[model samples]
Target: MNSTHDTSRHIGVHIDRPVQEVYAYTSDPTNLPAWARGLAGAVEKVGDQWVATASALGRVVVSFAPPNEFGVLDHDVTLPSGVTIYNPLRVIADGTGSEVVFTLRRQPEMTDAEFERDAGAVADDLARLRDLLESEG
Candidate 1:
């Protein structure tokens, strides 16, 4: 499925850490359970793919973008029912801190209220990530 054609919401949070630090942590799927409670319960690697026991979708395969210096953290989530969702995420440098952005897309059949709730969940997750990272500093 093409995510660009779907409705999307961009939510972000400012972390009191360097971009590299935030990117390194967030880009690792294993860390999703710590911050993204709405998305994952636990993430583990099976063969070449990373599988997460997601709170919303159960067990799903997750594939992240290749590591680069630009702080891109995009990933693809494939559900057990054979649906794939593309997520666009980024970590950007802001002074000595960093900004993490997550683009949440609405499924084609989702209602307006559902979309809003999903965005809110993403916002909450970002806040959790911010709090988790900042608290460690």
Candidate 2:
């Protein structure tokens, strides 16, 4: 496998809240700061685009897919270097609870260690999301 090729890691968590609730909470970019620490805790809309003011990747533009009843929460994060990263996410019904899954894509330029770190960050974010939803619901 070429080290410069892209890959992905699927990180997920189970929240005691309903799938609809989980989808509603996470699909809103404004609620990101409370759970996703990777954004450095701030985001705002710049005209039509949602921009994260501070992040490990610096200020980035985030664009999400149109809301639907299928629990799709895919988004694109455009980094400072003009690189756009696609993130795939979903909130699925699991009996009375829900399962949130985030697919972290490994950039072609990222080293092995960097990819692992990004994966870890994603796991942490999902864990936080679980805590927030399960506790507050």
Candidate 3:
């Protein structure tokens, strides 16, 4: 794949927890700081959206999909530049546990290194989530 076009990569992890429980915890914006390092170390509620006042991309706003039965935790993160990136995430049943999958889409202008870094970040975050959830059991 060339850097001139967009690319989609799926990063996932298997958490030793029920799908519903994983979905409930992950779907909440306030719980993001504990696992989603790519988002921010902290987030605040601003009106109906979650705002990260200090992030690598500067201040950003996050909006999540309403609660749903399909385990979808999709969200949009609007950067300081006002460019909103759609993040597709899901927690699905994996026997007694759950599998969290995050679709990381590389922007058209991102270089190969940047794309890989973003993918790595997602992988790390998912691993963190898995660790946090599995330890609870």
Candidate 4:
């Protein structure tokens, strides 16, 4: 539970949109591939759980926090190998715009290079989200 003890990277981007609007779009699991390149291949819902066909990880189940007004977009991704990754995401109001933050946790088996790569991927995704949302504004 101690995030300080664990290795993690926090990446975020500022979107030129209101918090509510940003949350509405990003909170939807179906929109993940639009910004998340790792999951850009395919995403579908099966019953209550969402499954994503990521190029590097293959098939994985994705679970998100229940609908709420707090702009908490936290999600968990379960890999085919049964390893579940907790991704902490949030959309916070900043003036008239919003900031989307994604915390990337380094897996126990991952090397430093892999962890950096994951962080880079998250940065890229967040930037994509910013561009998509801003351009729509």
Candidate 5:
């Protein structure tokens, strides 16, 4: 469901559950680590603010959300250059299911290969979410 490139990446999957449940799971950062493969743990508020640490990707604190629809995160990944990563997670409802999009734009000096690698990581995370939800049912 996820992809990477010089172009924008889109990752989506159809869940059998209601849109609200899917949105709740994604919007609540505390629940993120339960399904997100990249996150080891997260602390978050109900309305959608969070600070999280990824087992492999380091720590991140979500900075803002515009109109409660999109989130911007200030993320730090421990790498050689120690660069900051900006990630946006958007959620929208479509009919009976929900659509989630993860967009990443890193430091200007970041290479396309680096972007692709991270994008692929995002895809795997989403896939893990799908498995979690389906398994629960």
Candidate 6:
């Protein structure tokens, strides 16, 4: 099978900490809002999962993981134009800091502006994570 990064989106940030430390924090669903400022409030728990709200999308439940992989359930979220998309988030450690990758295939369609916005959000989150980890160390 093709690697997820082949067709999916990718972003990375290098925190001045051990890979294990960054991975532990990023892989925890509850700490997502700490890095992703767009999340309005604390993530809501469903069953045993926690839901993270994306800026343009509604609630997204991230699956539980220890340190390496973190994923959000693929589900349709409406856009302003009434279009929908199923976006799944994949996060892992790269050397030291964590790398966050998102997989999105157009449902109605995809736009450069939308992709840019999403990419910007991801980048900002990673930058914040790096800053926080480094400062704490």
* Candidate achieving the largest TM-score: 3
Write candidate 5's Cα lDDT for 1-137 as tens digits: 22333555666556665666676666555667777756546655435445666666566554444334332232333332454455666666667766667765544656777767877877888777767776776
* Pairs in steric clash, model 5: none
lDDT of 1 by residue, 1-137 (tens): 33444487789888999998999889888899999888788989999999899767899999999999999989898999999999999999999999999988888878777787888889999999999999988
CA lDDT, candidate 5, residue 125: 81
| lDDT, residue 18, model 3 | 96
The lDDT of each candidate is 0.88, 0.87, 0.89, 0.87, 0.60, 0.57
Global Cα lDDT for candidate 1: 0.88
Residue 109's lDDT within candidate 2 is 66
- TM-score of every candidate relative to the true structure: 0.92, 0.92, 0.94, 0.93, 0.67, 0.63
Worst 10 residues of 3 by lDDT: 1-10
- Give the better candidate number (1 or 2) by lDDT: 1
Better candidate by TM-score, 2 or 5: 2
The 10-residue segment of model 1 with minimum total lDDT is 1-10
lDDT of 2 by residue, 1-137 (tens): 22654477788898999899999999999998899888647989889999886656789999999999999999988889998988899999999999999988877767888888888888998999999988896
Against the hidden true structure, what lDDT does model 2 obtain?
0.87
Q: Which stretches of candidate 4 lie over 4 Å from their true place?
A: 1-6
